[model samples]
Every structure is written in structure tokens, then in C-alpha cells.
Target chain A: MAADRVTLSDVAREAGVSLATASRAINGSADRSVRPELVERVTAAAARLRYSPDATAQAMARGRTTTLGLLVHDIADPYFSAIAAAVVASAETAGLQVSLATTQNDPAREVQLVDLMRRQRARAVVIAGGRSAGSSTEDLAGQLAALRAQGVGVAAIGQPVPGVPSVAVDNLGGSASLARALLALGYRTFALLTGPRQRTTAQERCRGFSDALGAGGGVVIARSETPFTWEGGHAGMLRLIDDGSLHGVDAVVATNDVMALGALAAARERGLRVPEDVALTGFGGISTLRDVVPALTTVAVPMGELGERAVRLALTAEGDVVESVGCDVVVRASTPDLRRR
Target chain B: MAADRVTLSDVAREAGVSLATASRAINGSADRSVRPELVERVTAAAARLRYSPDATAQAMARGRTTTLGLLVHDIADPYFSAIAAAVVASAETAGLQVSLATTQNDPAREVQLVDLMRRQRARAVVIAGGRSAGSSTEDLAGQLAALRAQGVGVAAIGQPVPGVPSVAVDNLGGSASLARALLALGYRTFALLTGPRQRTTAQERCRGFSDALGAGGGVVIARSETPFTWEGGHAGMLRLIDDGSLHGVDAVVATNDVMALGALAAARERGLRVPEDVALTGFGGISTLRDVVPALTTVAVPMGELGERAVRLALTAEGDVVESVGCDVVVRASTPDLRRR
Candidate 1:
């Protein structure tokens, strides 16, 4: 069966050239020894034979595969999916294949995946999502350094990894802007739904929103920290509602759009009308969540752009740099102008 | 740097065993010539040295890579994302890495991806999505046949490919059932937003719903063909509404859930109240879409299970097989029981 595959020797025979010349021409060798006419003849013969160069052999020769590894927390989540999609599109333009791995939000699993990518000799790796605090970061930093040492490009999307180039979203600034926007909407008292303390993204967003609210002379009546997931938001909102935290609260702020959606669902279940009864706001304006009824007020982080930039930074950037992507505070029906009334 | 990587010889030297014995023990060679104590020593030595096997070398040696190639229409779409996430999870359990590629619903690109996967010597390839008609299908079939000839297993989700194992959803039956369920709700007239003519999934779904409606003495007053996407559905619905086609329609059926959500958005934009002025339904029970307000009435296709079964079939099946996955009609707030009213 292996013999059936068209090889450089076959192309060389068909093109009336030596095997070495065919290999040099087809592999685009840096040596300018192969004649143009011979290169053309070899190319035409390979095309005629429908020959595909073995990727494994190519990787062995190059010492790195044309594989861009993307590590995401969960592909099913719209946030990660959006990023993954962008990465795939960008990788395609660069003529690279994407090897996608899910960490399932497990730092150990993430470390293992990084090792796997390293072993595979992937040309580049883009890690999406926030980093949790602890030894996992140290372990990851070491692994990334090893990968970089091996000439494999590495980039991070969320929090900046010590010496790696990263595309960090302005989480704190975005959340603060969203908070000020909500304050302008005449929201004085609020309930907050935040994510776990270990995640830097959650912590930054929560602090930014709270600090901004305090500066605006607004108050956070209640707060609940849960997992960074829709279900977690739902449960946290339910706990707050059940504990009678919304009695005088003017609005509910969820740290992310998915969480805000879950909060909306919980509010609906409890017979609370959005904007009319209690206003709401969220962060990370995912486009897929656009059509949600009453429309969510959110900080529109350019999720896809983040992915594209990360891929670019990984494959092309020089030196350790932190590229910041800005966010816009999109005021929708979820948070209305109470002052106008 | 390549010299820095630990080799089998390093393990053999550390274990005080012959290179052949180390290779046979570490790679689990069929020949049981290596002694058990030597194997244990080699394994311990390899572990102690933190030696990660070179996947590229292993692939070349085995004539196949431990890669599961997954081709999806678009990963950003919740439907494909759901299936992709499942495929990744299932592949992980089998110790296979998923090489994801998006065809962007282009058959030429899909064929090219298949060729790319073949070049990579992927262990198995799972193509998820509907097939388009014409020369592209023949081209794809040829590519897939070539893949199988090289001992690479192949499986498909959605429409079955010739001489390949597939996990096919009951699209026709699901739509028929959905139509009947809607009829039971006392809806007499309907407007349909369908996909392009070339897609088998769209064609089957449209025919099933329309045929069932005709058989049940219900009428499809208007039908519009658009791209099988959210924007298409939105545009199709808006066109129908503007053209007065939906004036007397009791319900609107979009072939897929994303399309249905688009139609719902269009209806809302037109100031039409769901289950009052009109009702709406979508297919493919995407879990992410569960939070949409008014809740969607849909035929729940087990997307994750489809991916899991496809991986299993591609890797383990001995013969061409078609595994049918069932769909269930889920009644929700969008479609009300008009008879009660």
C-alpha cells in the first residue's frame, strides 16, 4: 500500500529529472540549485500524479509541523467557539491546520495538552481563556518556555503569561465602562453575579465594576460568586433572589454574557420583567446572544478579533508584547434609561 | 535542540537494556521477545527522564497518526460546535487528538480538507454536516475512497456517504413528527423557511414537513428557500412577512434551530407576538439555545451522541453501517396548544 503512494521518485521519473532535483523543487529548498524549467516540470508531474507530500516526513524535515494548536476551556461555550472559529479561519489563511484541545477548565489537563502539543512539534500554540492562580501557572510558564526554546511560537489570549506575548482583553476597563454606563442609566443599587476567585478574569471584572459603582456613588446591595458558567449564574441569581436581595436593587450585573443570560432565565422564572421590574447588564457581548429577548446590555469584547490577533502574534510577532483589545459598552433594552421616566 | 530531546537510546542506556529491547517494550511490539523485568526497567527509566515520545516519528513508524480529523461546516454555529465539542471529548477518551477543520459549507474546501487529512495520515476522519449535490460529491467520494484505501477509517454525520459508516439523524421523520405535533396544536396554516435546494438535510426536512402537513389537511401557504443559516432564516421570514405571505399563517417552521431563532427575531422586529399572532418552531435541540426567551419548540437531535457514535464507528466498525439516531419533539412556550384557546 505504501508503494502505491506517488513519491518524489515517481515525479522525478515522469518529469525526466533526478529524484534529488524533484525533491528540491517540490520541497521549495532554500538552495537555488534546481533549474526553473526543471522545477516547473517536477511541479506539473506531481500535480498530474495527484501526489500529496507526506506531512509527517515534511514535519520531520522541518523540525516542526504546520499545526497551530488551540487550547480552549470548552468548545461548546459560545465564547470559546467564537475564538476557535476565528483561529481556524486565520490559520487557514496561513495554510496551517488547527489541532483543537479542550481543557474542560482543568489546569492539569491544560498542562497535559500543552505537553502533547509540544511532543507533536506544533509550529504554534494559542491558549485561550483566563489563567487560574497557583502552581499551574508556573508549570504552564515553564512548559511554554520549553516550547519557545524549541522554536515553537506561543501566545496567550486572556491574562498575560510571564514572558509570552499575549492578546489581553481589557476586562477591568470594559467592566468599569459598563458600570459607569449603568450608573448613567439611573441604577443606584445593584446585585452582582461574579465567577470564582481563582480566575483572574472574573476577579478583574468584579473589582472594576464594584469600584466604578462605588466611585459613582452607587451601591452593590448583594454579591454572589459562582463558577464562570451559565448554570452557575442561574444558581447564583436564584440564591440572591431567594435570599431577598433584590427587594430594593435597581439592577443585576453578571460578569459575562452567558451568565447574564442565565440570570435573565432565573429572573423570568421568578416573574421579574427585565428593565421594567429590574434592569440587567452583562459583560462580553457575544454576538450569538444578540437576539435574546429584552436584549442584554453588555461590554462588546471583540472575541473573534482576539483570536485572530493571538494567531498573528504567535506566528509572527517578535519579543514579548501585550496587545490590548478594547471593548464597547453596548446599552440595550436590558438596561433602559430610568432617568427619562 | 533536536539532540536535546530524549531518545529511545537514552532510555535503553539508562535502563541498561539493548535498544531493540527498549523499543519493543516501549512501543508494545507484537513479538514477545523482551523480558518483563527489562520492560519494567525501560518504562521506569523513560518516566524518570520525562521522555515524551515524538508523535511525528511514531506516525511515520506506524503508517498512521493518532489524529481524528473532524470537518465541520462552521464551528461558531452552535449546532456544529455542540457536535465538535462531543467529538473532541470522545476522541480524548480514546487517546486521539482532534484535528479540526472548517469547510465553511464549501464542498471544494471539504474535499481539500479530506486530502489534507489523508496527507497527515490521520487515523480516522469524521465529516459533520450535510452534503451538497453535483461534481463536488463525486470528488469527495473519490477522496474518501482514497482515504479508506490507505487504511484510514472514515465516518460521517448527517447524510451518509457511499460505502462509509454514518450516524444519521432522522431528519425526515423528525420534521414529519414536528408537523404532526403542530397540527395537534390546531395550527392549520404554516409558512416555511427552508434552506438551499442542494443540501440533502434541508431538502429532506422541508419535504417531510410539507408532505406531512399535506397529508394532515394542513396547508403551507408560503415557502421560502434561503441559505441554511441564522441570517438566511431572518431574511426569509422578513420577506414573507413583508410580502403578506404570513398574514394568515398560524405557525412558521424553520428547518433548523438557528434558522428558527432568526425567524423568531424577525417576528419580534415586526411586532408580532409569538403564540398570539403566530407560533414558531425550529429543529436541532441545541442546548446553548435553551436560554432564548419564549423558549423554542424544536425536534431535539442528540448532537453530542452523534459525534460520539461517529468516532466509535470510524475507529471500530468492520463494515459499512448506518446507525440511526432518533429525534424527539419538545414542546415549549413558542408554540402553544391553540385548541385550548
Candidate 2:
């Protein structure tokens, strides 16, 4: 295929230039000599021949660039930010460079950004937050398979991107722990604030919360599905309070910190004292949560560690890849007394 | 300067081939009729001449590729996260794409990243938390100057890069506002906690804080500088408490959220109740702080907006261009409280 494709020689022949001269014209070497007329002809020839210089081919022939690419949904999210920091720190230790990219969780933008990373000659790629390019898991599977064939490393955070190594907190385990904590506080009725039902992290956390709390068949009478944004949490909590169900429910466990924080605000506006009147718990112990009043009693996933591990996994050889690791629980003062205040 | 370089015609002449055939040999786009021997000759001639394709040349002839490069210091910092989010959203809105590359305040990495971004043909470049390459501002300046010469749109955030356009907050005003707020509440003595003196934002904020309060007859006594990180703030606060001079100060002004949070923690350890005892205020109203007890009195910087603006400015031509905007002060219960606790 390389032989048949229009090579630099073809452009040289078409422009009636020496091989070295053609290379210089194409590369724009500073010290080389060239006539304006010859430069124009060489350019025209290059275009006519559809020459690309093939960045991928260059990588293969010249060894690796020792760079990897990382794309995420929202870097502002403490979860992603924590992971990113960890990843960069780790990458530095490994003598590898990371190229970071972000998608606002827009699917089209996700595909476009990933494509560009591939072109950058990245030997490995990490996708955090959003789903892959395909509409179906199978499609995502195919994308992974394609990357495998090309010898590119791929890993993801959040939902395991088809065949990629993924690192996550045992959402189910952690949520169960949180639920048990709230349950012990003698909270019968519960208000569940959830995230987008699609993402795996949200779903698993919800399941964990339910499994531990409802395991004994207590009560989880109220719930709302909102975006995993701070606003969503704020709005969701307000809605729970407005429904008057918050009065009946003794506890609130948001899928993430933002929602949990929002729930706290809503309870406050409703004249409820946290832990006294209504115990509130959030997941994802981000730095922001550390300063929250009655510091969040939540799960602290090693976000930065996840990022670094994800990168290492992607860079690992194809067949020898390890699976995933679990995160830990971080309990603060958010849930003090369990009963209604 | 562009015209004096070697041309493709020179290669064809040396290879004894027609211009089109030489072009084919060089670019690897040749029909079955093109002989392998001719291609060899073309490649040999090109190699002998040491050809290098002009990156800018290829870009001009080709339509813009769908990629943007973003550089920042620490993504884990809520400030950078907000900016990164804004940039990604803005880039998505513009139908342009972005790839992230973090410098982590390392000058060598910064230079390497810039080179990588240039090689990737990023449509524009945004550098947040940039520093001197090799920890020397001179080296960092030299690289930025080189990129400018190549016509790369350069925009920075948090601090000015001499000739670069920077999207930064009114740190001076914001700090002054916080100080002014405390003064209004009758807190006379203060111990300020600041980030590294090298950080532009940190320096600007310290200046603002001191200018506003220090000029008030040294009422703000002294300040300690720490890393622009949480632990730094924590350690600084501890130092103040152990030094026994804290009794002379009734309030503390921290430069940023992480440090402010550390201060809050330090205060709690010292059994100081917020507002009623030692009033506290933090700059950069980050997430989770809203959930903290006494809700940090802070300046809610437009972090996302800063990021979006930085991306836009990076896309524009460089010159004496400047954009500065005001931030909002969030009055929580941390400052000198007038309300009876």
C-alpha cells in the first residue's frame, strides 16, 4: 500500500525537482534553497498526489512519542479532577507525558475529540466520565477491538468502555456501607436523589444504597432523577422538600456530592437541622466536600489514583492487562444523629 | 524567507524523472506504470537532501483540523477545573474541539507540551497556570515568544505572560472586598494565609488583601506563605495558632479555597467558633464550602467564565489585548459577624 501511494518521489518527479529539494519544499526547512516557482509546483504536486506524511506511520517507524491522551466529560467534577491530578502526577513519575482532552459529555464531541487524539499518535488513550463513540455497548466493543488491532492502549473511568481496564470504587459496597450508616441512625423513610440513569457509577451507587437500606425492608418512599450537576442536586433536594415527603423521610443519600450538598440546602430551607431532623449523606468525597459544614460522611474514591492506574492500564501490553481496583469509604460528620430532629 | 528554501523540482532533476513522476515518487502516490527503481531514486535523492515538511505550509493548504490544545497547572484545583469546564463548553459551542495538556508548573513539560500542541496543529492554545520553562521565567518567555512568532494564538489565565492575553479575575478587587467586608464587621486584627509568592493569582490576592487592610495601620499584622495547596494553608494556620499571636487577630483571610478550608480546619482544632470567635474568609468560592459549617465567607469567582474567555482570547491575534472582569463576594457566616450568634 505504501509503495502504491503517492510518495515524496512522485511529488519530486511531478515538480521536476531533486528528491532532497522536494523534501525541503514540503518540510519548509529553513536553511535550504528553493525558487518560488519550484515551491509552488512542488505544493501542487503534493496536493494532486494526496500526500499526508502519515503521522501514524511516522510513529511506527520512529518509535513512540512517549505520550498518551486522556479525555473526560467534565474536569470540574471533583471525581474527574481528582483522577486527572493523580494521572498527571503518576505520568510524570513514569516518564510519560499525558495529553488531556475533555468532552462536555456531548457524544458527538466525544467522537471528534477521540479521533483527534488518535491522529496525535497517542499510543494509549483514557476516556473518563462519558460513554464511547458507539450507540450500543457492542459498538463500543468494536471500537476497543479496532484500537487493539492498531496496537493503541485504551482504558476508561466510570462505565467500563468496552474491553478497557476500568478502576472504580465498589459503588455497591460503599453505598451499602453508607446506607447501613444512615439506617443505624434509625432513619426509616429515605429520600433518594439519583444521577442520570445511564452512567454506571450512578446506577451502581443507587443499587448499593437500595440494597443495604432496603435489605431489611425499611423505607425509601421518595426519589428524584436529576442530572449529576450541583444545580441538579440543589433542585432535586428542593423538590424533595417541596413534596413534603422530606418530612416523612429521615435520610437522604445522593448519588454524588453535589446532589447531597443540594439536599442539605433544601433541608435547611425547610427548617430542618441536619442529622438532628434529617441525616444527609453524599458519595464521592471530593475536596469541596471536605470543607462542607458537618463534613460529608461519604465514600472517598481515590480519584487521582484511579486516573494514574487507568493510564498505567492503558499503557500495559495487550494481553497482560489487569482488571480494576476498588476505592475506599470516607466518613465525615454529615450524618450525626439518625432520628428526626 | 519562505521562498529561499529548496524546491521539489530539484529532486526530480537529480532523479532523472519528470516532475509529476518525481512528485509521485516523493509522496508515494504512483500508478502501476511508475517503476520501483524510480521511486527508490526519488527517495534516495530526497533523503540525501534532508527534507522536512513545513508544518505551517501543510496547515495553510489544508482545511483546519478539528483539534484544540489546553494547558493548565493543576486540574485538581477547583479554579482550573472551572476554567477547563468553561473552555470545553465554549469549544464545543464553537464547533471546534479541544485536547488537554497539563504542565503541572514544570517548565520543561510546558515547553514539551507547547511543542506537542504545535505538532498536533492545534487551532489555538490556552495555557492556564503556566510557568517559566525549567523554573526560569526567561526560558518560559523564550518559548512563548517563539510560538508567537509562528503566529500561534496564545492566551493565559490567572496571570499575564508579558505579551500574552490573560483571562484573570479581579483578584485585587476581590481580596479587597473580602477585607472590606471584615472591616465593616469590626474585626480589627488579622493573620492572612497566602499561596506561593510565585503564583500570579496568589501574589495578586495577597497584594489586594494587604493593600486593603495592611494600610489600615498594620491592623492585618503578618501573613505566612504556603504552597498553593490545602496542606499549605493548614500548616500556615497551625503556625499562627502555635505562635500565640493569633489572639491579636480576630479574623483570617485566606488566599484561595483550599487554603481557606485548611484555615477553617485549623480554627476548629483550636476550638475557635466561627464568627463568634475568630471570623474567617476565603477567596475563590469553590464547591463543598457551601456545605461547610459557617459557610465560608468568600468571593465567588466566575471560574467557568474565566476558562471560556481564555479559550476565546487564545483564538484571537496577540497584541496589546486585555480582558479583566470583576468577581462576586459571597457573604457567608465566616466573616466578622454582626448577627448575634
Candidate 3:
């Protein structure tokens, strides 16, 4: 028995009870048809045996584990945090618990987490992502298919994968509006700091900015690409300055708030005045920028709403599912005043 | 059968296999003298019969579930988010999965999550605080104790619970140094926007700030306590201004970055010059703040490391473990230049 796995039957045998009764005792069920002493016996037996209940079997017998898995690329960003919060709130409302896992933009981790969620027999899995520089998400697609084949519901945030419910901000529309905001403010020179190019969100944002500013009678633009992070923004802005590429650029737009914050810092270090000598803005309206100096003028996506929507869809998906959401722009002091670019 | 809770034995009977053989097949143990086709048969039957392995039973049989539950109050906060990222990284290294839930500082939610996590048969559970205004956590102390009695390793962030391992920041030391920084700069009057007074971290911060200022000679201190959030900070700062008390304060020390950002806006709205009229400093060196205008000088906490540590303790703990770790302060611009102030 020491060399072999100790199963539930062993515990039941030791406690002189049926397997179900043993389960009831370990689960702390209040009303079993057994004596209190029997409950105590089962409990002692379980403790002695060190039982870790089979999640799958319990889920099958108990109707559900009342648990869901949340998959994200990273959790440190306010954007994901916002969505994660919503997912938790919505899952609780539906009587299901959600657990969050960050993939760190690694598709291998993505596949591992999805598979683990399946093995744990989670009621549902909500997968969210940002940009990934390495590994193709084609495997995520396969995992989605496998889980669906096994009757597990799946939800996606960011890009809508086939056969999964999705919630996403309108990366293009938000980026376009931000670019238009900058253009209408009369800023001619523009610097861009985008997320990993492969990420659909970053790609859409870049496209939106280009269309809004480079279309028809648009102004001169100088652009550079940087990862969607504060460090990237800081370094990208510095690179632009060192290269003298920012000499004529009057405005800088980052794909996300972290990068924008970085750009703002870079500007400050160089003695550049924001919204006066240089206007700075970004996409995601993370909280840090909400109250910063010359509060960032950017788009605020309903991240919590996205997380909530994803969970609701995963819980209630009738069949193969797909959905999308958009974002709204918040104007603040960081953008150049309309009267002066 | 539909009304009779679906059982693994039912699947075994339907698949015409012995219980042991069925267990081996369903668990995907390929080396147990079972043909691949037979293994496939068992799994297919499980899916068809909706057999969920009992989570509690499975735990007893297996030493691991590859599932971990992370409990927190707010995922949107950068500190918590950082910790979450760290937890994910560590969990990946251990070949485990993470499940996250937010209590929103609500004690009832906290109770609900703990119960759900137990049912899900998580190997470890990590609880971070939620702002509980109505329901007292005094009731939760019992629930947590019961979980401990169940033999599940639990870890926490912020403050330690009895017999549970927790990761805590050096709130007193960090706040003390921040206050002293401004005091050394000869700032006599201070407006302090603090976090929820009920939280242990916030209490320590208050004590530290008071102690620092007291050592430098008594100074007039105007303070307001609010929940840690952007709106709370903004409203708290506004209150100081409307009360005509802000003029008497030369600097503001907020307990968190979000609140500090709010204070910055309040200062701007009140036409008070930053660093010129009232130097502002905040706790939590968030990535988003790196972009704020004039930047914020504050203490940076390794939120990610905290998350990782909490998870590690929970995963590796043996019996009745309690642990604490110190936090380093990250200096930012929110604290004014000592010479200038």
C-alpha cells in the first residue's frame, strides 16, 4: 500500500463505510445517515490516508466543481487585471469560481494551462492574450478544439478564435480616434510605440493610426516600433530622440498605457514639455495614467466587461461561439489642447 | 442514472472493465498492460457518461492536482497584478496550474471562494485581502481554520493569518522613510491620504508616518482614510482642498500610487503647483506611474515577488507554517527633491 497509490476504496474499507459515505465525511457534509463518531472515524481515516480527491470524479458526481479557469498572457498589466476582475465577478455571480493563470505570452504555457484546466475538469476556461513574440498560437486553436470535443466551454479575449466565445476592445477604432484626436489638435510630427507586431491588437492599432493620420491631406509622420511596455516606451522614445527622428515629431502615441508612461518619462528626462513641446498618449487607460501629470488622453476599454462577457459566454455557450467588444476614448490633459498643438 | 449521481464505476461497468483497469485507462496510464484502443475506449466512455473523477477522492489517491488557487481582493491593482504574474511564473516552473479569484475585499466572497476552492480540490490556496466594509473577517477566521484542518496548504498576502504562511510588505519602514524624506526636506505641513484604516498594512503605514514626523519635531498633520483606489485618492485630496486645509500642507503622502495620482489631480485642480506648493508622494511604484507628468516619487513594492513567495510557501509548506518577508522601497518622483522641498 505504501508503494501503491491509496485509493478511495482503501479509506472506505478502513472506515467501514461505503465510498459515498466516506466522501461525505471528507467533504464535511453535515447530514450523513451515519453517526457523528463514524464521521469522525472517516475524517481521521482520510487524514491518516492523506486523500486528495479525484477532481474529475468529484466533478462528475457533484454536477460540477463550480470552478473555471482564466487564461491570460500576463497579469501585471492593468488591462488584463481589469478583465480578470470582471471574469471573477461574473463567475461568482454564476456560482462558479474562476482561477487565473498568466501565460507570459508563451504559447507552450498557454497549451499547458489549457490542458491542465481540462485535466482538472474545470467547468469552463476563459483564455485571454496580448502580443506574443515567439511561438505560433496554432496550438491554442488545437487545444480549443480538443476541449470542445470533450464538451468543455471555451472563451477568448483579444482575438476571436474559431469555436470560442470572445470579447475584445475595438483596437482599430480606439487607435483611430486617438490618432484623429492628435491630428485635429494640429500635431504634425508623430512617434509610434506599438506592441509586438504579430499581435492582432497591436497590428490593428498601428493600422488605425496610419489610416487616421496618413489618409487624405494628412501631416508628416515619423514612426518607431517598441514593445507595449513602460521600458519599451522609455527606450523607444529615447531611441527616437538619439536618432534625431523626434526632432519634428510633436506627438507620440503608444499602443498601450505602459508604453505611453514610458514615453512620458523619456520626454521628461529630455526636458521635453508634454502637450506643449510634445503631446503624449496611449491606448489602454490603465489607472496609473488616469491621474498622472497631464492625465493621459487615451482609450479606456471595458476590461471588466470583457472578462465578464467571456465568462458568461463560456458558462452559457450553446455551441461553437464567437463575440467581440469595443473601447471608448477618454480625453485628458496629456493631449495637446485643441487651441494649440 | 441521470438522477443518480454519475459515478466512475458506472463508466467502468459500461466499458466492461475492472475498476482498476478503468482507473488506469481514464487516468491515461499507458504502461499498465492496456491497449491504446482500450484506453481510448475508457476515456470515450467517461466523456459519454459524463464521469467526473471525484476531486476529493482523486486528491487522496494522487499527491498532486497540478491546480493552485490564487485568492485576492483586486486584480486591477498593479501590486496584486505583479504578484499574480510572479505566481504564474513560479507555478509554471513547478508544472502546476493556477486558478485565481477575487474577493473584492468582501468577506462573504472570501468565504464563498474558500469553499469553492476546497470542492475543486486545489493543492494550495492563496488569499489576498478584499476591502470588507459590511461583513467582518472575524467570521472568516473560523472558515480558514476549517480549511487548515482539511490539510490544504493556504498562503496569504498583506498580513499573516494564524498558522498560514503570508507575504507582507515593509509598510511601516517604507512609509517611515517616505515621510522622513519630506521631513528632511524641511516640509512642516503634510496632507496624508491613507488606505482603509482597518487593513493591517494601512495601520502600519499610519504608525510609520506619524513616528517619522514626530522624530523631526511635531508637524501639523491633516489626514483622511479611504479605501485604496483612484477615486478614493481623488476624493480624499479634494476634501482637503475644499476644507481650505490643503494650503497649510506643503506635501501629500498617499498610501498608494492610485491615490497619489488622484492627489496630483486635486492639486492641479486647486491650482496648487506640484513640488512648488505641495510636494506629492505615493506608495506602490506602479508601471503606469512611470509616465505620469513630473512623475511620482513613491515607494515601489515587489508585488510580483510577493505573489511568487505566497504561492511557493503554499506549495512547499509541510505543517502549520507561518512566514514573513521584507519589502524594499523603490524611490520615485512623487517624493519631492529634498533640497528643493
TM-score of chain B of each: 0.92, 0.77, 0.81
Residues B171-276 of candidate 2 have per-residue lDDT tens digits of 8998887777777766678887878877767878888877887665447776888887778888998898888767767788888888888888887888877767
Candidate 1 segments whose C-alpha is farther than 4 A from its true place: A1-3, A6-51, B1-51
DockQ values of all predictions: 0.65, 0.21, 0.33
**Higher TM-score: candidate 1 or 2?**
1
* iRMS (Å) per candidate: 1.7, 11.1, 5.9
Candidate 3 lDDT over B1-341, as tens digits, reads: 12455677889998888888887776544245577888888888898997766543454345445567888777877777887788778877776667777777777778877876665556778887533333356556566666666666678777766556666677788888876777776677787887888777777777888888889874656888877887888899889888887767778888888888777877788887777777788877776565566578888777767777887888777665655555455555455555652
Number of the top TM-score candidate: 1
TM-score of chain A, predicted model 1, versus the true chain A, to 2 decimals = 0.93
The TM-score measured for candidate 2 stands at 0.76
lDDT on C-alpha atoms for all candidate structures: 0.88, 0.71, 0.73
Candidate 3: lDDT over CA atoms? 0.73
Model 1: per-residue Cα lDDT over B1-341, one tens digit each: 44587888999899998887887777665335577988899999999998877777667666678899999999998889999999999999999999999999889899989988998889999999999877888888789888887888899998888778889999989999999999998999998898888898999998999999899999999999989888999999999989899888999998998888888888899988886888999999987567787799999999999999999999987677999899999999999999999
Stronger candidate by TM-score (2 vs 3):
3
Worst 10 residues of 1 chain B by lDDT: B25-34
Q: Which structure is stronger by TM-score: 1 or 3?
A: 1
Which candidate has the highest DockQ of all?
Answer: 1
lDDT of 1 by residue, A1-341 (tens): 34588877889999999887887777655334688888899989999998888877777665678899999999998889999999999998998999999999888988999999998889999999899888998899899888888778899997888888999999989998988988887889999898888899999998989999899999998999988888988999999889898899999989888888889899899988888888888888877567798889889989889999999999987688999999999999988899998
